[model samples]
Target: MRLALAALLLIPLPALAGDPLTAAEFEAYAQGKTLTYAMGGQVFGTEQYLPNRRVRWAFTQDVCKEGWWYEEAGLICFAYDGENDPQCWKFWQDGARLKAQFEGDPEGTELTEVEQTTKPLSCPGPDVGV
Candidate 1:
């Protein structure tokens, strides 16, 4: 019984109708918005989506990174300017909210969109002492 239960829990969840959102669909939904993502019930970070798939991501630490996304093999992958490695994620639209699964994570990290707004993301300029 324990084995069966564990297996059921391990099964991957289908993101609405057992299909991930296509590139056009994802773009239409995400563009022109800043989305707050939560992991483990805590706000992990926020991302502001701009036109032409441009994105600015900031962690709770307040460090922002500029990047852009493209669809590859049905997964959306982001490549930041300073980061050499590309981060890929699978997105799902759950009703009015959205959910994302980080690719290559064995533990399955699911980030849920908790809040969204058209307001711009606050990114501070370089440090300059007054």
Candidate 2:
């Protein structure tokens, strides 16, 4: 019984459903849209995709950051205006929605597209006070 259980544990788990989307596919589906994502059943962040690969992202109720995205090593990587290191993700289309996994860790957080709209993101600049 112990050996059987050990073998079961050693067996690799199944990968996430669906193949990762190609760069062109992602571009077509995401461009000109704003998407909100959730992780672990809680709202995580939102992002707006613009032409020329430009993007705007913000944590829930937080300030936004301007950025751009590109494909690298089969992952979609993003570079923000002031951030040095790029954040990379593997994206898969789930019916009308999208699922993303952080490429930095195979078992890292996975985000699900909770909402999408054609409207632009509401990004407020810094130091706005009465």
Candidate 3:
């Protein structure tokens, strides 16, 4: 019985995943915005913002920026300047805050007071039953 209960708890719950965004809406939200990221007080600028609704973030390079991104399977995936060679980082957004964990990094940081040219974007739909 205990094993059965453990198995039940491990079942996939798709609805607990994030909300879906439309392509048009994503473009609008990300077009002029900026994503300021920091790791242990070391700051980096993800200065370009071009977005797709189904995807989370897009764009790249220190120059002309080229990448495609999305949040699925509990991971944030970004494919930049190439195919079959995507980079993924894990993340969670709550209310006005965002947190992410980079690969090989033991700690994650919450992005605070994140300013966008427009209002901040929250995760899609209602809260998951976390």
Candidate structures ordered by lDDT, highest first:
2, 1, 3
User: Residues 1-130, candidate 2, lDDT per residue (tens digit)?
Assistant: 9999999999988545668887898899899999999999999999999999999999999888889999998889999989999999989987778999997685787999999999888877664211
Q: For residues 9-70, write the lDDT of model 3, one tens digit per residue.
A: 99987532224333343345456565655545655434345435222332222323355666
lDDT of each candidate versus the true structure:
0.88, 0.89, 0.46
Give candidate 1 misplaced runs (Cα > 4 Å).
Answer: 1-18, 127-130
TM-score of every prediction relative to native: 0.83, 0.81, 0.46
Per-candidate alpha-carbon RMSD to the true structure: 9.1, 8.9, 11.9
By TM-score, the candidates rank as 1, 2, 3
- Tens-digit lDDT string for candidate 1 (69-108): 9999999999988899999999988778889999999999
Worst 10 residues of 3 by lDDT: 53-62
Poorest 10 consecutive residues by lDDT, candidate 2: 121-130
